[model samples]
Target: MSAPKPSKRPIRSYVIRSGRLTDSQRRALDEHWQDYVIDYEPSALDWNALYPQQQPLTVEIGFGMGDSLLAMASAQSDCNFLGIEVHRPGVGKLMHGAHQAELTNLKLMCHDAVEVLEHCFEKESIDRVLVFFPDPWHKKRHHKRRIIQPAFVSLISSKLKTGACLHLATDWQPYAEHMLEVLEQEPTLINHCGPGKFWDEPERPATKFEQRGKRLGHGVWDLLFRKE
Candidate 1:
């Protein structure tokens, strides 16, 4: 699972490219990805109507390359998966992984996750939310771009079912602390893991990037929060 670091990364146009959606993902999910998913915009998505079995749904946002998403879905087949990501290439890669795993109880959306939460889904519709290794936004000017801001946390909280879980992970210690601070302000969420939680790594497969991070002597953190 080792790959040479991608070389000569190009500055991509911020414009969304419709061509990036892979055919396999389309064939797998029966989803036709839109060029630009609107923010806080709702689409007609009904869980009960879509799947008669109506299994509990787990939503993962910013799944960098979807390595963990594929692994978790493989291990937990009984639960349905809903993935939201802003990057097109990553979404395309996730589609490939979902297809390769033959995952049926999975769906994907390429839109501002907040919009998905506000518009398409109903209250208590989601059972779990996972945000892993989001952009650190190290630069002071770009701090607003960090995903764990208080406002964003409030929106995410609105989408969860009672007793649902919200899990977050970051390799950056600063952002990890930021996540805890912002989440603490939200009265709706209660920290389920103790002070020892930040020190422990959850049981998960070694991703290509995580393995590399470990080789470089970096520590990864996991935070598991529950809805009160």
Candidate 2:
């Protein structure tokens, strides 16, 4: 059964201004917002059933602090993006930024990406999936918490259309390598590891987290895999 919808007014409404969001981004969010502008509950979502008839959708799991999400919404007006994040501060920041920048091609939800994927989305519905800089959970014991394991790759592959892409970026070489290994080994996906992966990583506005990661000498690597 689908989960019931939450209250009309969001528990927290943030308005981002003079920060990472560009004027154009803010404007896009504003132009596209509507009643039920954002949804925080992921349990009730019926991803397989709720797609807008007019356009295909892309999803981003664990959209850390949401800079890339808003930027992508502005950069690509044709496709809608569903952003799933468990972090309240990040949600507030993204929504605030979206509200401030007037981003319309995006929606919000807070939940576990795994549960949502397994329960909510119907088979072969997603056009693309983006996971950028997810928490590495680097500890040996906590590695189970990492989201890029084989099972996830299998599930993600099942959900994506034949040619849909799964894109992930990480500054941690270890995580990047692990992800590359897993994605490469998966029979359902093929690597798109060309130089353009960096040059064409969906044009996004810069974020503070990225800036900090850069200053710390962390190099970012993007891995693209297409569902077979």
User: Using Cα atoms with residue i matched to residue i, what is each candidate's TM-score against the true structure?
Assistant: 0.78, 0.74
Segments of candidate 1 deviating more than 4 angstroms: 1-41, 195-199
| Maximum-TM-score candidate | 1
lDDT of 2 by residue, 1-228 (tens): 999988795222112223464555455445533421444444445543443534678998887778878888778878878888766556666777777776656787666677777777778888999887777767877666678989888998988998999988777878888888888889988887652234246444555566778999988777888988
Can you write out model 1's per-residue Cα lDDT over 5-42, one digit (the tens) per residue? 88895332123445554666554334433321223346
- Give residue 88's error in model 2 in angstroms: 1.0
After TM-score superposition, the amount by which residue 34's alpha carbon in candidate 1 deviates from its true location, in angstroms, is: 11
Error of 1 at 59 (Å): 0.3
Q: Summing lDDT over every window of 10 consecutive residues in candidate 1, give the lowest-scoring window.
A: 32-41
Error of 1 at 56 (Å): 0.5
Question: Candidate 2: minimum summed lDDT over ten consecutive residues — where?
Answer: 10-19
The true-versus-predicted C-alpha distance at residue 141 of model 2, in Å, is: 2.3
The C-alpha lDDT values of all candidates are: 0.72, 0.72
